[model samples]
Target: MIKWVAAFLGYFLFRFPGAVLGFIVGTFLDNFGGSGNKASSVFQDYTRQSVSPADFELNLLSLCSIIIKADGQVNQRELDYVRQYFLSTYGKEKANAIFRTFNEVIKKREVSAQRICAFMEQRTRYEVRLQLLHFLFGIAQSDGQVSKAEVEKLIEIAGYLRVGRNDFESIKAMFIEAADNAYKILEINKNATDDEVKKAYRTMAKKYHPDRVVTENEAIRKGAEEKFKEVQKAYETIQKERGIS
Candidate 1:
């Protein structure tokens, strides 16, 4: 929408110097609070403050790419996970911009992880860094397990974030334990029957039922959902592998 308006106004003001001024003013006002609309001020302010020195879009892409690399294979499922996350959180236009930035970041083989880590360390808040680490861990464990590569990079990023090694180990263990429990809940193993799968799903469905969690404690709902998804994925993987009916 902004781009369309900018293009139209730019075309209209092609010739005169005043036209350039008008376009600039108009674009700025449109983005800010033009036409007596101060609605976007808070959001704009937050974005400006959050992304001043380090480009937020570029940084996010770099972090996500590193996470994808962590899994060793960089599968379509992980790529899809990234795309869906950006689309849901940042909207399609910004998501496209970030993905383009990610492509550029991936091209530079000479880029230094340490320098990038330094930039992120200096720029973002501790809370935001923790959220990012959780997100990366969630992505790595999305397919019901975490690869060694994923574990390695998780540790690397945790160190860069200045999270203590002990803390990092604890967090990693927590998520991995959660993931393993999810797999167990689904009865994923070398031998499992169709009845066992159905029974396990029923048991987990009752255990992780969102209505129960939301009613009991809203705080646990999100974690429950993630855990449940892993259970489902493990079930699917086992079923596919064993050719279960």
Candidate 2:
């Protein structure tokens, strides 16, 4: 872990300058694309992140919001990702505000990556930062799809968080890759028969089983509740698709 942390810090420092430049360019393009429109609102929100004072977790939340908005539209997959995270990490009031502010900000016209990074540098604790990076990767993987752009952006955020390459990859596998086949919740595939579907559900339920996770990490157990629900949902979807009651 110490080695991973050290590698993470080095990577971030190395990539810091380029990321700042890219953020500036991205913000400018967002503004130029829509001088005065709803899209412009997103740009405005993106740029103003500079002035807002936030703690590490909040800063991470803001950054995730930006990345989620990057592909042009926010869908249920991303929403489920964010909602699961906030519900797990914070109380209802704080979670509500975090979600609300995230929605409100991304609607603006411009953003300053330099300012955002400065906030992260000053405010984020190393562990919390790493966790947030992991969460963004989870969001990116929700649809079982990763674009070149999204992967690059996630790497950028990992660099900013000073997360080591190995640790970041672990995060990718744990959160992103694990959650990738979520659309499977819509139907069981040809390779999977009725018995296979039941078997998959049993496996997932055991894996995300809240009781098991709670025994391991009381802090994250409640958060696992939402994930466990997804497992159950998938099982139900498979049953419905197969007409197996």
Candidate 3:
């Protein structure tokens, strides 16, 4: 077991080459001893190395391209929204570099939304997938409205990502304004009692909580935090409407 762990540590050390990788290797070794069949499955799933940060960024920008062009035209407001996201996550220099690459890809229109989503579904965790969906919605609504074409494209991409209908609707409510949007955001019904609303809020909060994303990637965690805030805002909106504290 010592030799096995040492071998893994050595490989990870060479592959990842950072303190975070060290911590991950240590955790893997600690869990490997007690994990059983389930642990083996987990090791196989996570240890294969999920998408790298660069690849994730590229995939995100590629998908964003699809979203912005959903209405057959790319709006500056939509591009700005994506640029702001990259700016906050990667800072000025890297964000500009990414934007340049994104523009190049956008001009070529070569990145297939279905293919990118498939890669994400196979490589990313559910929390990450949810975050991606949320980001896409933000892009869709950047022009102050989510057109039917945009929503249709988003639905198709969500399907490719294997995101559940409930989860997709939950995120969709955050952006697309409607009379019963608050209820949809909370994944509840208009006729639901205050107590039921509260329970639903708690359930959605737990599911979309940023802390649920266990990754060293700060950008991914930040994206999850945005979704968490959206869930909280939805709950608050319902509370305001129902006069529930």
Candidate 4:
């Protein structure tokens, strides 16, 4: 429906907060307007939209392909991780449609991470781009250990996506464990003052809130929720270390 497209664009343009606005406005138009399938001015400009939603899926597949081949050996667990996540988040039919492209076109060639990241940076919101990085990390770590080449590839891809060093490190910490990784996840220093830790927790929580990307999709919400839980875990770890309740 045009309304779903509108809702998706709203989220795509403004992040998750705008999804409700788009859906409500869409319903209002559906009830009050005529029976034509024309798009409203509020829905789209058509000219400005160089990237379609389908483009997101394709570019995402490209990123996955790049990562899978990063270490020069394809691990079935990593491949299964990618496929299962897609199936759970996007459903069976749609996941199959995407995998068809992945197995057919994307895997057949050397996908340029630069080209895909360039396309994504032009069209995606920062939060969504962060999610993309997180997804790649998830794939890399799915097989028990992250190979050095895989981490290097992920860092390079993050650079092309324009993700800052801290943000990239934070996502990396979520998978690649370290002693002070919890601090890294919160984007705070290991010796940050208790008050500073509290402040950082609040900030990161808001940034990674489930509502930020949870609109209209349960599995997507779960993805955001997992990130949010990491922020909580970081805060708790710091709190316990400092004996602050």
Strongest candidate by lDDT: 3
TM-score of 4: 0.77
Residue 65 Cα positional deviation in candidate 1, in Å, after optimal superposition: 0.9
By descending TM-score, how would the candidates be arranged? 3, 4, 1, 2
lDDT tens readout by residue for model 3, 28-55:
7676554344423432333233456567
TM for candidate 3 is: 0.78
What's model 3's overall lDDT?
Answer: 0.79
Instruction: Compute the lDDT of residue 53 as modeled in candidate 2.
Output: 26
- The parts of candidate 4 lying over 4 Å away from their true place are 1-50, 214-221
Please tell me which model should have the higher TM-score, number 2 or number 3. Answer: 3
Candidates ranked by lDDT: 3, 4, 1, 2
Model 1: residues >4 Å from true position, as ranges? Answer: 1-50, 178-245
Better of 1 and 2 by lDDT: 1
Model 2 misses residue 133 by how many Å?
Answer: 0.7
Provide the lDDT at 30 for model 4. 72
Candidate 4 local lDDT, 214-240, one digit each (tens): 233333456677888888998898888
Q: Residues 17-75, candidate 1: write the lDDT tens digits.
A: 54566567667766655322333222232221233322544665677777776554566
Q: Name the candidate, 1 or 4, with the larger TM-score value.
A: 4
